[model samples]
Target: MDMEERVVGEVLVVRPVGKRIDASGSADFKGKMVDRINRGRNLIVLDLSDVDFIDSSGLGAIVSMLKTLGKKGELRIGGLKETVDSLFRLTRMDRVFRIHPSAEEAVLALAAAKSMAKAPA
Candidate 1:
């Protein structure tokens, strides 16, 4: 799992430099994300532009990581290739998870949601 992470002001921009996110690669990524979330850095933007394929295990790992982040913080996926996007659609995970058309847009949207939640109702 080749990855690069940086804090863009408030959001963590994590880009994986890989063509495929298989079981092995995904497990490592999940562990890293869980560790990050546990340490209180849960807001994340996953750039999937370079990732072309993801198997069932990979998708499951992503979902589990998102669940761990929960409501306090969230994981947003962006830059999905058509093939991977189709897989998410087929599994109905597209509706379950936040899919962004672009990483920049996702960062803004999720950040907005977070800010709104903090506002008084």
Candidate 2:
């Protein structure tokens, strides 16, 4: 699997270019995400539109990455196929993650949420 990353202001967009994100590729991607988070990149939007397939290993990788990100930062997954979407729901991970329709939407959602939190109640 191949991965590309771009930073849009404080938002980091990580796009994995591959047909599957299984054991063969999950480690590298997870490591890269961990590195980014360690570098103080908080807001991460994982663009999963290109990924039409993901197995248990891939899911585990993502779960691990989410933990590395912790509370100070977050990992928002976007553009899930129906199967992938169903997997998340079935695994009960949909509640743990913030899902977005697109990478742009994820970025915007984070911004809006941050603004709201900073605003007076």
10 residues in a row with least lDDT, candidate 1 = 6-15
| Root-mean-square deviation (CA) per prediction | 1.3, 1.3
Reference-based TM-score of each model? 0.92, 0.92
Question: Stretches of candidate 2 above 4 Å error?
Answer: none
Give the Å shift of residue 73 in candidate 2: 0.8
lDDT of each: 0.86, 0.86
The TM-score of candidate 2 is 0.92
Q: What C-alpha lDDT, on a 0 to 100 scale, does residue 47 get in candidate 1? A: 84
Please name the candidate that would achieve the greatest lDDT relative to the true structure: 1
For 15-85, candidate 1 gives per-residue lDDT tens digits of 88888889878889889888878988878998888888899988988898889988888889899989899
In candidate 2, position 21 carries an lDDT of 91
